[model samples]
Target chain A: MIKRKRRIETFSFFDHTGICKHLEKMAVKGWMIERLTNFGWIYRRIEPKNIKFEISYYPKASEFDPEPSDDQKTFHEFCAHTGWKLACTCAQLQIFYNELENPIPIETEPTLEVQTIHASAKKSFIPAYILLLILSVLQCFFLVSGLLGDPIDTLSNTAKLFSTVCFFILLIICTVELCCYFSWYGKAKRRQSKVSFINRQAHLFYRKLSLLL
Target chain B: MPRAKFQTLTEQMFYILLCLKDECYGLDILDKVPSMTAGRVNVGSGTLYNLLEQFLDAQIIRETKVEGRRRTYILTEKGKDMLKKEYERINAQVTDYKNIFEKEEIV
Candidate 1:
């Protein structure tokens, strides 16, 4: 029997570390992630064991591609050669898993890793925000014009009312998601600076400025 | 881009470029770096991959060969120069440390 569970996880966008850690804990308890989607993570029960999970951003990857591109395949092969097994992929975000006792985490250069994630987020998330902004502005324009032109028709239409509510809901979600992404990046950048492989001058500058203040 | 960032290499990058000095496969660097650093520095797969792309973009490294699912690369002239500069910078730091500590101990 293949037992499965769906966990609603919209907040994964807000918290990358939290989501990866949560998935690792789940894997520890014998539930392996069978499917990861915008809807939620679907897990299947397995023999109880520990597994290591790593999340990485591949700027070149795309969800619409019928197959993983040559570059993506080469990347996966290289990772497998180094012991990380590709667990799943959602758009630009790729997750790898290892059952080894102590596997090297795939992202060693902290500043580079943060920058990679930021670049990927900019490509995927920022566009959605722009689209949402345009749609909301258009919707509001239509709503206002409709009310001014004919109040009864605009208010009486149930479909438009429902869509307006949904548009607002989506707008709220877009705003929150964008905010969370930048906030998470802000914190992640600060954390990465500690273990950064480069950018010592920038770090020194920041320290000196903070001291001066 | 400033000239200084090009003048030095991070530990991860130094080892990476060092291993690629003789035209090595990408996977080989993962194993070679740990041994070279005596298990002190482990270049994670993602980091290595990204750095390779960045190096290629920056023309520090050039793809040399593609053999049966492996891609081999070697440091370019620019990469060699960067490595040499980084070596000198590290040596200078060590020299400065020895001078300061040894002189203080003598005093």
Candidate 2:
């Protein structure tokens, strides 16, 4: 018989250390992360064991790619030769595990690791936030114009009222997400010292939401 | 862009470039670094892998050959110059360590 559990995975893009520590704890409890789902991570029961986890950002990798590209394959092979076994991957984040005692950590050069993370985020959240900002701005422009042009009719009509409420919700969400991204980025840029992200509480909220689902 | 800052590379970066001074496969570096440093320094695979990519991008190293799953790399001219500068910088630091043995010496 196989026992399994689903838990929301909390990984603030900058808090790689936190996620790795979380996984290490899970391993201590005999739960190994089996797969990533839309909501969170699903774990399968296993023998309680100590394992070292490492994460790397592969900017060139795509989740949609049918097969590992030649460069990625070669890179993995090199890591394998060094005793780190590939565990799982989500999008561009590659995770590896090692059962060996006190293995050397994957990220050695602190400044380079920080630089690589910034480069990856440039390709990801920066564009996402910008697009969201543009969309919400357009949404606000239309809704505000309509309200001002004909105050009585705009407030009287249910359709316009519904859209006004929807746009406001979107605006709030976009603003919050942008703030969260930049705040974390700024703190993470300092590097070296272990940094905790402010979005941890927000992530815990999502984890609870995922648990219900 | 301060030339002096970059002219001095981290221990791992210095050793990685030194390892590629001889044409060798990527995997070979995994073992070579520890052995050369007499176990004092260890370069993790992920660290080494990413460093190799950065080196390739910066033209510090070039892929010499690919044999099946293993790819060999060698230092380029730019890499050699950088490595030489780093070597000289470290030597200069040791040469300047005249006050550590004498407490009376002041900056």
Candidate 3:
């Protein structure tokens, strides 16, 4: 019997709540998340049981770190005191699980939680997504200019047409992601209840789009 | 406008500072707050960890001892003063309530 499985789950970087719910669902089916890797999320087969999951972001953490830093270790120790065991970490994202039924949560202050998430996003995804948005916009502009400058040459080149389409798709994705993040950030700042801003339609659309790409 | 830094302590922050009154291992506060509040209030481990870091940065709490991963902390003078101020603020609210409602009862 296969004891391990790996699958790519494209959750937004800031969707820790969504990720926790998904992981909890996976645990009920007998697969426990072992670690997150460049390949995908690896799950180890376990006895089918219910477990609670929580995720937190540490902005100072980096993927390049050889091992957990002293501060991260201390944070984990504190969580462990409340029965939260560290499950895995992917860069700044930390996943923890608690077998106890009524364990106190790891994050109680919503404002602080949002700030930490925003800081982590800035450190990683925010900049990368912004750069991708810029590159896609430039590519689309050049493609359009070429089309206008020489319609025949631009239309006849299959590679050019394909690249143009890809750049357009990239542009759309980048724009949607940035807009969604900023909107969520704005709402979260006003009220922490808005922290769990899961755009299911957009998420589904992205999943289908990724499969196509 | 953004909230002023630590101007008013939230419930969790108040309890955290209350726990720090006695030098105790950082993790011990996890159990202390809930017990102190009769399980009415609970501090999440992540919340405690982050608050401790912020308090240290603000010089509200000072690390007293470290034994490998286990470290102890105590409220600094600044922290104590802040806690006292919060206590007085809450007391004033209660006093105001009594002044209005209790006087009506006597009348």
- State interface RMSD in Å for all models: 3.4, 3.0, 1.5
The better-scoring model by TM-score among 2 and 3 is: 3
Off by over 4 Å in 1: A145-153, A190-213, B1-7
Q: On a 0 to 100 scale, what is the lDDT of residue A208 in model 2? A: 48
| Candidate 2 lDDT over residue span A93-133, tens digit each | 77788888987777676666666666776777567777877
Candidate 2 chain B has its poorest 10 consecutive residues by lDDT at B1-10
Model 3 score (lDDT): 0.89
lDDT of each: 0.78, 0.76, 0.89
Give each prediction's DockQ, rounded to 2 decimals: 0.50, 0.55, 0.71
Residue runs of model 2 more than 4 Å from their true location after superposition: A10-14, A152-170, A191-213, B1-5, B99-107
The better candidate by lDDT, 1 or 2, is 1
lDDT of 1 by residue, A4-101 (tens): 98876533342456556778888878888777776778898988778888788898877787778888888897789778898888888787888898
A94: Cα error in model 2, Å? 1.5
lDDT score, residue A63, model 2?
71
**What DockQ would you assign to candidate 1?**
0.50
Candidate 3 chain A weakest lDDT stretch, 10 residues: A192-201
lDDT of 3 by residue, A14-121 (tens): 778788889999999999999888778899999989999999898889999999999999999989988999999999999999999988888998888888888998
